[model samples]
Target chain A: MLGEVEVEVYAEVKPTESEVKVKRAVLNIIELDELEVIDVNGVKYIHGKARGLSYLSRIRDLIRRERIRDTARDLLNHSVVGDEVVINVNKQAAYVGVLSFAMGEVESPLGPITIRIKSSNPQQLIMWLTSG
Target chain B: MLGEVEVEVYAEVKPTESEVKVKRAVLNIIELDELEVIDVNGVKYIHGKARGLSYLSRIRDLIRRERIRDTARDLLNHSVVGDEVVINVNKQAAYVGVLSFAMGEVESPLGPITIRIKSSNPQQLIMWLTSG
Candidate 1:
């Protein structure tokens, strides 16, 4: 009789470091990269990393399009609003803005500084803002 | 000659479900559990999962204590300001909030709702706010 041989197969991956440090807060984004478009089942979006601190990980991806339409139906006439948020950029001081909407940007300084609606870094922002 | 034997190893681990639906934002925190305290290397901090959409993976860990002291010395008397930001929670409507400081909590609804300094949910906050 022949002896059976066993082997382990490992997937090819480098465990991307999607992390960032805005001011003093650290964020981590697992399995992300610069401009990597991804789709989870039927959802589509992109991945990104936080810079600066090595403890913060975050992600920015587009929601499933179907969900948008569903939300519209479930809450028709629902007027979307914005949240008051503040940001500080590389010693440039902090500026106040409103996160009216969201757009997944695989880049940092996320979308040319000032945006009309929505923003990233809320968890990070609140963490920093609340931490005395 | 003596025969040799080998054994396989396994661990007690299940992929964590750290996701959120901030408007339409998505974030993933690998290997995280609600209110699970963690310590990697010499760093110690808490872990949290986002609420909203799934596609964003962001982290909010306090920088090493020594780093904070270093930054203070590096930029003495540097006035820390705020960034113009916005937010919308449930049906409470949108309200602009500045993430001036950060305090990690293993719980969501992140604190009593409103805060003074620091906040969480940037990548998520941004993803939803921008996805028009």
Candidate 2:
């Protein structure tokens, strides 16, 4: 049984970018209980935190709509390290309400929206996310 | 005489960036009379407008401080098209109050801060900007 889920999302705001739009891009993918902009060193980042699998409903729907269940499942499977799974999506694509997997940090010129999920049962969480 | 100068500063706000920092980046290089964020084709951009050479005082100072007068002059010379001179600077560097020229749009992963300046006397403007 999946007991509890914790999620964290981060996106770097380039000096040329708007905080409001970056927030929208993150919200477009997943709902967060807390969201704010924080400066790490000299770089500004959009940080989001939430608890429970309910917040990931939009991401689950996106995978289904985009017909990437197999790809997403593989990605999630490989990303699982103990109790956590990490996913990166293109920020530009997310802003337009689309989910595009970023294979690496350099996949997008503006960087990716990094999503981290921790669950009591990561296997079950992955099953629930990718399963029809 | 340079007469009058019109300057427009623009930077794209990526989803992960803070508007305040981006504004700081632009202000670090030049002063603007009006600055705001506007949505263009669903993309957010920092738009700035100013008039007169006084607004460009910071940029001129930066050129002298960085000792890039020769290089800056060459860039300004090449960028001159009609009555306008265009320059692109790395936004990240600008945020930290440093002026680094962007050779191309792809020079920075987050894109560059594009500056457009129109002057009644482009030759005089260039000389005033680069000359000691």
Residue B131 deviation, candidate 2, in Å?
2.6
B50-106 in candidate 2: lDDT tens per residue?
888899999999999999999999989999989999989999889889999998756
lDDT of 1 at B117: 16
For model 1, the docking class works out as incorrect
Tell me the lDDT of model 1 at B14.
9
TM-score of chain A of each: 0.20, 0.95
Supply DockQ values for each candidate. 0.01, 0.38
Query: Candidate 1, after superposition: displacement of residue A95 in Å?
Result: 21
Residue B27 shift from truth in candidate 1, angstroms: 28
Q: Residues A1-132, candidate 1, lDDT per residue (tens digit)?
A: 112211111111111111121111111211222433345553322333323321111212111222333332222223223332322111111111111121222222122122111224333333332232
How many clashes would you count in candidate 1? 117
- Residue-wise C-alpha lDDT for candidate 1, range B35-97, written one tens digit per residue: 333455633223343332321222112112223433422222122123212211111111112
